[model samples]
Target: MKVSEALSSRRSVRGFLDKPVDLDTLRRVLAFAARAPSGGNVQPWNIVVITGEPKQVLVNAVALKIATGEREFPEYTVYPEALPDPYRTRRFGVGELLYANLGIPRADKAGRLAWFTANFRFFNAPVGLFVHTPTYMGLPQWADLGIYLQSVMLMLREEGLDSCPQECWVTWPETVRRFVPIPDGHLLYTGMSIGYADPDEAANRTNAERAPVDETTTFLGF
Candidate 1:
């Protein structure tokens, strides 16, 4: 698929079919994604791809913790404690639209919790990718990591795979680190669920709206 097509087609897929993604296909996508540029060529990203029993084990552990109310270290806040202006309003609007489609009213905290819990299950996808990096890395390196991840998602889309980039995995970072046996000194950056899209699921249709380019960008040249 063309780059433009991939960019437009890629979405944060919440539901996936039960099909397994082959290792070779994943490898090829990752190889292409790794070409994303980084400052001073310091490509500081590590990915742990899990499938089959290993993936199940990680999910089960997190679900058990959630059931028992045993919280691990908290992940970074997704938004500011007190968000300001148009960005905050935009965030609220998308969230409202998504929950509305799911038949969850603003007052239904339990329903929202249930939906959030599904992130631990990978939304039934067969493959989970945990991305990590050194804990001490600066913001620029983290920015680079984000670019690399976007490349991965776009390439996966081009290859006919759907994906969800999940920060929810960070809530169970220790569980993941233990199951994956990742060494110390690296933080779990995020997780991704990848597989074929489940066309029948309503959750899969939740597309967060984006602001128009004119609202977000400032042109300097005539």
Candidate 2:
């Protein structure tokens, strides 16, 4: 697929089919994703891919913890507590849009929590991936991780697969470390779901809007 097509079609798919992705296809996608640039060529990322029993083990464990009201301490803040202005507005808007698409009313706390719980299950995607980086790395390395993941997502689109980059998984560090072989100094940065999207799912159709260039960016010396 063309790059433009991949960018346009790639969305954070929330539900997926039971069909398994081909191992070789996944390998190829990662190999292609590695071509994504890194500052000073540090690369700065590692991943543990899980399928079958291991994936289910994580899903079950996290679901149990969440259901039992177990608290989790994430390694770092996922979002600022006091978000400012347009950024906060955009976040709230997309969340409302997502729930609206799911037919979840504003007052349906249980309904929303039920959907949020699905993050651990990879939205039913057959493959799960854990991304890692050494704790010593700074913000630049974290940014590099985002670029690498974007490449992976686009590559998945090219391979006729779908993905969701999930920062929420970082909240359950212990559950993830038990399943994935994370190195001692490395921290779990994020996770992803990879598989065929369930075409009929309404959540998959929830397209979050983006701000126009004039609003979000400033052109200089153009």
Candidate 3:
């Protein structure tokens, strides 16, 4: 697919069909994604692709934690405790939009929790990818990792596959580390769900709105 086409079509797909993604297809996507630029050629991102029994193991562990009332502190704060201005308003709007699409009213706390829990299940996708970076890395390296991840997501779009880049994995980092055997020096950054999107799912119909270019970017040179 053309880069523009891929960029325009790509969305964070929440619900996926049960179809499995072949390994060869996944490898090709990752190989292309690895070409993404990084600071000083330091390719700091490490990806663990989980499928089959191993993926189920991690999923079960997370469910167990939730059942046992065990909560993990996020490795990093995704958003500030107190967000200000347009960002805060934007976040609230997205939440409201998503819930509205699912017929989940703002006052239905239980319904919201149930939908949030779906993240741990890979949104019913067949493949799960966990991204990691060394704990010693700084902000620049983290930014580079994000670039690599975006490359992966876009590549998947080119392959007729869909994905959701989830920060929700941070809540079960230790369980993931143990199951995936991620080394001690590395920190689990995020998880991604990859597969064919369930076209019929109501949540899949909800797309987050983006701010206009004038609001987020400035063009200096004419």
Candidate 4:
């Protein structure tokens, strides 16, 4: 697919088909995705991709915690305590749009919470990729990680697959550590669900909005 097509096709897909993602396709995506630029060639991203039994085991561990009405204090703040104007509004808008598509009313708190459990379930995706980095990696290295993951998503799009980059996994560090093998120095940064999208799922029909370039960009020398 052309780069423009890949960028346009990519979205945070909330539901996936049971069909297996071809392993060779995933490998090709990753090989090119790793070419994402890193400062001074210090590529800090570490990835652990799981499917089948291993992915199910990890999902079960996280779901078990939620089933018991438990919450794990996330190692990092997923969002600000009080997000600033435009961003806060954008976040709220997307949630409203998604729930609306799911036929969930604003009053359906229980329904909404139940639906959230699907994050750990990988939205029924067959493949789960956990991204990590060494504990000592600074903010710039973390930025590099984001670039790399976006490349992964675009490549998946190119491969006629979809993905959702989930920071929700950050809340289940212990559960992930127990089930996913990681070297001593690494810390779980995020998780990604990758697979064929279920076209019939209403939750996947999100009308997520983005700011216009004029509103978001500050042209200094254009």
Best by TM-score: 2
Per-model TM-score, in order, reads 0.96, 0.98, 0.97, 0.97
- TM-score of structure candidate 3: 0.97
Which structure is stronger by TM-score: 1 or 2?
A: 2
Task: Tell me the tens digit of each residue's lDDT in model 2 across 125-189.
Answer: 99999899999999999899999999999999999999999999989998898878998999889
Per-residue lDDT of candidate 3, residues 1-222 (tens digit): 899998888988989998999999999999999999999999999999999899998889998898888998878888898999799999899878888989999899999998999999999899999998899999999999999999999999999999999998988877888888678888889999999999998888878888999999989987
Candidate 1 residue runs with Cα over 4 Å from true position: none
User: Model 2 — TM-score against the truth?
Assistant: 0.98
- CA RMSD, predictions in order: 1.2, 0.8, 1.0, 1.0
Error of 3 at 206 (Å): 1.2
Residues 1-222, candidate 4: write the lDDT tens digits: 799999888899999999998889999999999999999999999989999999998989888888898877666888999999988999899989999999989999999988988999999999999998899999999999999999999999988999999999999888899989877888889999999999999998885877899998899986
| Better-scoring candidate (lDDT), 1 or 2 | 2
Root mean square deviation (Cα) for candidate 2: 0.8
Candidate 1 lDDT score relative to the true structure: 0.89
Compared with the true structure, what per-residue lDDT tens digits does model 1 show for residues 156-189?
Answer: 9988998999987888877888898566888888
Residue 130 lDDT (model 2): 88
Candidate No. with top lDDT: 2
Q: Candidate 3, which ten residues in sequence have the lowest lDDT sum?
A: 173-182
Better of 1 and 4 by lDDT: 4
Q: Is candidate 1 or candidate 4 better by TM-score?
A: 4
